[model samples]
Target: MNRWVKALRAPFFTASAVPVFLGTAVAYNHTGRISVPDLILTLIGVIALHAGTNLANDYFDHLSGNDDLNPHPTPFSGGSRVIQDGLISPKGVLIYSLSWFTLGCLIGLYLNWRRPGNVILYLGLIGVFSGFFYT
Candidate 1:
């Protein structure tokens, strides 16, 4: 309803929790241990990453002038209102994008250290690049 609430992208945020559920399921299926508590941390971390990325995408798209266009809705745009509806500023989007991407990188670094094979290096690097390259 509101711009701020819309910006959070709650559905996207919830999707982050999918990783925790998936991880726990895999661990249980393989190790026979379903540790809900541990998964809570996983969920939190993942949620952060997802939220960060979503925010980053929103922010970057707005900054790049892509959101300001009046083109037909496509897969990427999905008809976002920031640009078309003039819901927010480009600078505002950049600030939000930088914030979320930074958060994602921070969490990703932590994850890499905590779990070496986290593929965090790959995920983080690509993710950061995507933020810019998705121009």
Candidate 2:
């Protein structure tokens, strides 16, 4: 469990979660109402996207020898050292990253179904594309 958390870089989820929270707050303020389920789904989707992005980055960094070359790596920089430290295999990282990306897209699809437009679909596609290719 601890290894998974480190591999997922769970601590950095705040960077993705904070925006969802602020967006929900703003929507509630404007509408005077909130859909808790949608909010929850949004949070989950965003976090999954974030986790997928982090894992993808780490895997690509490993492939590029970036993480391997780093002399010192902290929790906040140089990517997670799970692969370098042998805590998680590179293949495991890629599989987990793809799985997270799939989960995020599924949640986004559900959220889009609840909404009136295809906005979420487009956003999700863009996110996945950019994140996967970000390197």
Candidate 3:
């Protein structure tokens, strides 16, 4: 449980959430309305994307020996130490990352269907592609 939580990088969920809450607040201010379902879905999708990206990066960094070779690493700057600390394997991280990414895409598809703007789909595609290609 602890390992999973660490792998999720719960602290960094804020990175995924702040923009969402900000946008929600702005929309509520401007339109005087809020769609609770959309807000909840958006938060889940964003957080999943962040978690997947982090896990993928950790897997790739471990594969490339970058994490192992880092002489000095800060908690915030270095990759999560889940793999380094033997909490999980690189393969497990990659699998879990892909799972989260898939889950996020599925959620995005649902949101796009519900909203009917295709904006969510496009953004999700862009984010997933960029994250996957990022080293």
> Compared with the true structure, what per-residue lDDT tens digits does model 3 show for residues 5-61?
788777888988999999999999999999998899889988898889988888888
* Backbone N/Cα/C clashes per model: 0, 0, 0
- Which residues of candidate 2, in runs, are more than 4 Å off? none
Sort every candidate by TM-score, greatest first. 2, 3, 1
Candidate 3 runs further than 4 Å off = none
Q: Write the per-residue lDDT of candidate 1 for residues 34-132, one digit (tens) a residue.
A: 656556645665665555566666666655566556367553453345544667665665566567666667766766787758686787787577644
Q: Pairs clashing in candidate 2?
A: none
* Candidate 1: stretches off by over 4 Å: 34-38, 63-65, 70-79
Candidate 3 TM-score to native: 0.92
* Candidate of highest lDDT: 2
Give per-residue lDDT, candidate 1, residue 109.
74
Error of 1 at 135 (Å): 5.9
TM-score of each candidate structure, all chains considered together: 0.67, 0.95, 0.92
- Candidate 1 versus truth, CA RMSD in Å, comes to 3.4
What's model 2's TM-score?
0.95
